[model samples]
Target chain A: MTSDAVSAGGDPRRLLADTRTFARRVRVAQRVTWLPLLVLGVVTFGAILVQAVSRPVTTGCRTTDAGEICKVWNPVLESYWLVAMVAAYVVIAGGYLRVARARGLGSRVRPYVIAGVAAAVLMFTLIAAGAGRWIVPDPHDLLNPSTSILVLFRLLTASGGIGLALLVLAWLERNVALLLFALGYLAVVLVPINFGWGSHWSGKSEGAAQLIVNGLVLLLAGAGFALAQRLRASR
Target chain B: MTGPVDTPAPESHPVTGLDDVVHQRVRLGILTIAHEARRVEFGFLRTELGLTGGNLSQHLAVLETAGLVGIEKGYEGKRGRTWISLTTAGDAALAAEIARLKQLIARVETTVPRQGEAS
Candidate 1:
């Protein structure tokens, strides 16, 4: 029978057209949602690399049971690195909010963005404060502080970092794998510090740890970009 | 020319198997967009579908009344915005509509003869 004889059936062409339109719309939306986070990840990796290279190292003093002791390098640069990393995070959060607004993601996302920014700021301030104490010591004691405050700040910093990471991850749903990689990176960094494992590292071991962590970060960033490219190409 | 060519009856055809509300072009577009996102903005839908504010609102109202979509109004910064999302019922309806469309396509493929065969 001629196809025209089946006129009572809906047009197959029309259904196909609708399906194509839906698919196209979804593809466009996914691209818009993910592109920003991907760019931010690359930029963050670059900033970290620059900070690592430019970081200044100098001999410093520590207070031990015997007397005032000298250490090979003061971690002053680490503070600066933390500041730069936090700044990058703030920028990413701000950019995400702008993109969401532009795409009409509604006002509901505003609170999450605000919370993310606040967490970034809190993390930065705590790290900077700890670094300041190291660089400019109090007259009575150069190395030690109230142990309670030290532990409190460390906990706060970890919480803030996790909070910001989660907010960014939620906004960048398309790059979920990358975001999880980032969270894993954070966990690797924070878990050791939380347990005070760094205190046991000798000077040489400290350097080795730093190198290993930095290498892992580079690997994660590189893998993230590659996966993002594969996803885009497939799309 | 051949006395209406004996068009297939409605009961015998698969077109009647489709849902009227979900099959509409604009409504279908709305459902498709909402399904992709956690929650979609009213402005986004209007821009994507190329519908006026009032036109989109009417369609949204119909969907809302039918328990297919939920509309939320809230403020972002200082400005008011409306968010649109598909209800559970809406998601199910959309899925069913898509399945029905696929079945129809398959039926057409099996029943319609190729051009070379006709010759």
Candidate 2:
């Protein structure tokens, strides 16, 4: 309270302790991770609807020394993803800026937004260049029991680059929880999961099931973080 | 071999290294928060330090005059807000102050006698 509280004869230990506590409080108060998590979750979940509505247009199939490479291009899906990803980044940036303005605190989310937008553009470019067809193969072969696991890694682009860009956000926020979630999410993106492999769940769309699961994971993490933030605020 | 080169001895005490502008408790808190946040609003600083508007304004003016902090006035939506950011000099001064504080604490611990000590 006093102007010269930390004068020469004063206790440096107390001042240092109080400063540390203040810094911790500021760090906690500025966190707004749940907004992006929830928004991305919804965007990812909506991918299933887009998948069902947009039919794949096959250009042609050719036989090569390596294998059969079919060019099945879906302009609808590509456009949807490009627009969705760019919009999501805009929404996230706006959300952070709004929160910062309201709370009178600054957020370090620009790097995350930039990385996300760049990743989305890159994914769209790669797909347009015929990378998706080469990696995914024929739709009929996708659900076959003998389908290669490598084929399923295509699901990593389910959220249109939002999945990998989360790592950038984790670094920006310096959030360990978010970093852990991002790593786990990356594993989910890379690993092909057949939810209805053996049970009554069979005959269902395997890709759709995987997307639903990914969306649920994001939603659940968002809810958990929101609750934790609430508890911290209440305390 | 040539004569040994002379090396200047360190300061008599770490207190000599302490910066007057940055040593006060409130000012140090302001600089610390600004350094961490990169840009902090004036209202947030006032609320966090539990200081009155006048007191916070006085401290900010001192910091601004010393060229240790930069002040920008802008509108956040319809409301006018003042933002404070630490300068390069401010950051360096804070680091130096912390180092001096650490040295001062270390000296006190080593030289000061504990309870029931012979000295």
Candidate 3:
């Protein structure tokens, strides 16, 4: 029994470092960050197909002092996202449960799922209440003075909501990596970069192209984290 | 380096402060993992420490007997699983062990010179 004792008589720093490393391994083993990221990434990426097939209808036009602001509605895209996001949330929760059971670990994935589904519901509600008209940028009104407000409104979109909900997930996980990814994803969602170059290559719309970029970020982050965990575990 | 004048008493050494039950290599590893995870599974502990089920169980039994760890034997689904968590006493013991280890490190580092350094 005495022989099994750690020889703290030796360099304790190495011992401390080894202990910390083992703790990190345990943490990485239990994390399901990659699961949610991959799932959400696929959903966001798939939205491009829905966007491509659905035609935007100019429902109505309102005359304001600034100019004519027309309401653009894409019922198909909206409906598809509503179902997709809900399903994604369910799948993520189930995935966590499965992994936990298989690995004999406990999972705190419920709050994240709840938060994600809530965001999806909130987006659907806003759209149902006619707030969706205000979200889309009207082609006719080019230099709208409320551009900042419009950007803020992006938080209500599916991608933006996913980003926002991830902050909740990050908090629950207490993982700095997830928190950083969530912040980065939120920035991309709010002020989407025009990846029109990718659109031309893929023959997809600019909207779809942007979604693809967001989706790629999710997928890459997911894969990167999973790979890192595996490497750590192997070590 | 100055010549040593008098040796300290053995009981005054930082290593003396280490709890025998918590200071063992496997038991220390278990406590550290449990402290970090808050709640850890028995399988994870066994795998992480590279210990057999019986070996890990013996260590866990020692920890439980010392009131350092709380172990639960329950079923996750149809399969029964064991979960290990640090009790308040366990948490305090771990903290104390680390603190002692740090003190031990500091003492050794200050008294000992690097290989390349002038003695």
Ranking by DockQ: 2, 3, 1
Residue ranges of candidate 2 with Cα displaced over 4 Å = A1-17, A59-61, A132-160, A197-206, B1-14, B74-80, B99-119
**By TM-score, is 1 or 2 better?**
2
Specify the highest-TM-score model's number: 2
Q: Candidate 1: lDDT of A78?
A: 47
Model 3's TM-score against the true structure: 0.67
In candidate 3, what are the lDDT values of residues A105-168, reduced to their tens digit?
6667788889898888888778655674455455344335366765767777888889988999
State the weakest 10-residue window (summed lDDT) of model 1 chain A. A1-10
In order, the B-chain TM-scores come to 0.85, 0.90, 0.85
DockQ of 1: 0.14
Residue A35 C-alpha lDDT in model 2: 82
The models' CA-based lDDT, in order, is 0.59, 0.77, 0.79
TM-score of each: 0.47, 0.79, 0.67
List candidate 3 stretches off by more than 4 Å: A1-15, A49-63, A68-83, A108-111, A121-151, A165-184, A195-206, A220-235, B1-24, B74-80, B88-119
Higher-lDDT candidate among 1 and 3? 3
Order the numbered candidates by lDDT, best leading.
3, 2, 1
TM-score for the first chain of model 2?
0.80
Pairs that collide in candidate 3 are none
Please state the error at residue A21 of candidate 3 in Å. 1.5
| Candidate 2's DockQ | 0.39
